[model samples]
Target chain A: MQKEENKIQAVIQINDLKKSFGTNEVLRNFNLQLNEGENIVVLGKSGSGKSVLIKCIIGLIKPDSGSIKVFGEEVTDLSHDNLDKMRVKVGFLFQSNALYDSMTVRENLEFPLRRHWVQKGKENVNDLIIEALKNVGLAETIDMMPSELSGGMRKRIALARTLILKPKIILYDEPTSGLDPITGKEISRLMLDIQKKYNTSSIIISHDMNCVKITANRIILLIDGTCYASGTYDELKKSSDSKIKQFFD
Target chain B: MKSTILKDFLSETGDLTRFTMSFFREAFRPRYEFSEFLKQCYVIGNKTLPLVGITGFIMGLVITIQSHPSLKAFGAESWLPSVVSVSLVREIIPVITALICAGKIGSSIGAELGSMKVTEQIDAMEVSGTNPFKYLVVTRVFAATLILPILVVLSDAISLYGAYLGINLKQVVSFDLFTNQIFEKLTFSDVLPSIIKSYFFGFCIGIIGCFKGFYTINGTQGVGRSANSAVVTATFVVFIIDLMAAQIADIFQIT
Candidate 1:
């Protein structure tokens, strides 16, 4: 276990969130709270509004109602410029590892840094890119393009790119999805390692029970649109609720 | 088979239209991702050069050869380079480049975003305090709008070279004399309207392609459908806009 240092406060708070697409209510009165330095897993099947909930939190899709706050600042309604600036503090590792196909891994990791850091004079960019790649265990894949990477390696590279900005809150949308079991376990372990190394609060979106057990300090299960339960792994295992039991089975 | 194909086409088109409206709405709302924009320019412009260049060259050469004998019937073969340059610069290059981009960038965007949708990357961008619409569409549209004109300038120049090479195959004309002839009869009216129309062509390609890709429906098939629709629709719009621009130019006695 990593020692708690600086011990930042609750990084994200949500209240009465709601969203709908046409007649389908994707989220109904969704709410969540995440403390800084904690690893929280959101478990739900595909289209159960798990991903939708995170998208709202990140301000990707504006909610029809309710609010989201990061570090006590309302993130949901920020203007474009302000919201873009706010995004610097939040990191997301996309499930597909959305690496820019046009760039080499070195260029990929260096991209954000070159834009904000090198362009704006934030010391040197190469060292930071190297450091980020090293952290993700992709140091040797530096010169290769995203197309050249294996599925698992691509995810690691994506994670490295997310870490380049040193965000205070990290969001993972199915970080282990579509990987082989060995690779999936590696990714879950990597997530834990990243959480400890960065000491940042994390919200991991996944339906994998093993992933939830390995990475989360607390698990929030979304059934339909609302958060059905919030508890530790041990409590979730013991619960007598049919749906919760189904999740275990 | 026909019913299935028609049903697929209609549904795909409907989704494309929906995605396009959302993009326009999102574009006006806020934050421009400038870094993403620059990266898109490099992708949409830099990487597309060789393909667009080769197409432009062949187009210019073909135009010079086919139109040469007709003008020769009137004993106007000296107008060869000038004619090809004007048509290539003012019309063919931009339209063809757009269609090419429609194929390359459009399909790439569709495939990329479709995979993201299926794979949940778009959702990840959203949850990470990022607006995927602004991150994706704005950057792409901006790239198409800004980079198309420059690429046109480059392709036009190269195509004229190819046209010159084609002309010299049957006759002798120095580069200086050909350019001098080209510029001598090339009025602002002929030059301006053509370049202006190409910009719109570029914009249409970018907008339609991004719109389709962003709104991609279903699984991988949705992505393929968007890519196809974007190219087909953009190609049609290019010709329509060209006609409108030409008629407007005619009102002023231009080419």
Candidate 2:
């Protein structure tokens, strides 16, 4: 148990993040700190830079100023190759699921593995793919095309893909946006289950209230690019402020 | 009416010039997306084959049927195979195939990539650390450049079948005699220059389509406009390139 004391803190840390596209600034002085095993839910309206914020975290978008550190390595000014190297520890779930439509699910799963040249020595990729699918409750679909899968099923396949790298942090962009309530609940539960099993930190971008209630260890409410409110659900619920109270009651 | 006409002319010209600059800038940038390149080959080369083949067959048959009476009147009906073969190999097939590709490949590429841009998929890729140009542009251009020549070669051979059939409509020419006459007139100059020009046709098609789609803005309306303009301009450019190549080859022959 003494080994727990020496464990590193803050798996991800961001300071005063800023970005602008033309005359419009999207993210303004956003700051966040996430512990090694915490699940932080960020809430925002559409086009409020929720996706943009996640993109920045994964090195997809460049923030104008400020610092971002993943696993204590500064990521603001990494070179192309170095940035890709950093991405090895990050698993991102895109909103559209973005599975290559022309390729089958097996090919989709095998893409990064082939690109990065991973090998399990002719034992077949079936076990690994099945295990990933099983984790997301989609074990029966390894050969289906993306076109054949329902939307919720596609999202699960995407989630399974995100788990392939066994990331230190999982960044979900609107993980349940288009899903029906029942399917959405399954996905939310799946995320919590995956986090607990892997003991990894998660930063989920969601505006779904029930999702916020079910998943957040802490909530970061974003308005105009900065945190508008920060607290636990219980603390947030007990508060008197109209904005924070309105979210729960 | 004059002002409207002037405005239309300016818009077209500005689009052409802007397209040129964007392609040049993107070409020099760092990210090289190799996977997108392979995907382009699959899309451009494989997908367009059925259309190219059908069009080429019809083209061959029509050329043979039309050239018959004129040659027969000259008492050079025996020369029908050679004449049609030479013309097909030297000009018609390559130009026609390229124009067809401009319609098929050029429009689809513009639409697909244009939609991706409008829907923020390109931005998603950029954020994902994938260089959209190497993945998107180079693959497409390389596919078009390589595939067009193969399509032209296939079309050339089939069109000759058309010429032979055309001669047999009034006069019988054996397969052996037809083949002999065709190669006799099919000089290295004719074949080489024709195939060489097609690579340029492919490049113009690919570059114009990619340029239009990559930089598209507005929304759905913009995507439709981009796709339409890409085909029209790419077709226009292909003909111009063919003319220039013909002129240059002629100069080479004289010099």
Best by DockQ: 1
Tell me which residue pairs clash in candidate 1.
Answer: A80-B31
> Per-prediction DockQ scores?
0.28, 0.21
Per-residue accuracy of model 2 over A1-249 as CA lDDT, tens digit each:
554542367888899999999988899999998888899999877888988888888887889998899887888778867876777688888887877666688766765454344556334566667788889877778899988999999999988877876788999988898999989988899899999999989999997877777889999888888999999988888889877776677
Full-model lDDT, candidate 2:
0.82
Task: Please report how far candidate 2 places residue B189 from its true position, in Å.
Answer: 0.6
Q: What is the TM-score of chain A in candidate 2?
A: 0.93
**How would you encode candidate 2's per-residue C-alpha lDDT over B1-255 as one tens digit per residue?**
999999987996797677656656766675555566677778787877877777777777788888888887999877878888888888899999999999999998899888878855665454444566666776787788888898888878777776677677777779899899988888888889988899889888988888889878888899998999889989999989987987898889821
Task: For each candidate, report what fraction of the true interface contacts it reproduces.
Answer: 0.36, 0.11
Which runs in model 2 stand beyond 4 Å of their true positions?
A1-7, A119-124, B1-43, B72-76, B112-137, B210-229
lDDT of 1 by residue, A54-113 (tens): 777767778899889887779776886677677788887876787766669887676556
Best by lDDT: 2
Alpha carbon deviation, residue A149, candidate 2 (Å): 1.4
Displacement of the residue B230 alpha carbon in candidate 2, Å: 3.7
lDDT of 1 by residue, B134-251 (tens): 8877778778878877877788888888888888888898989988988887668766776787678777778777777766778778878877877777777777887898788888
RMSD of each: 5.6, 4.2
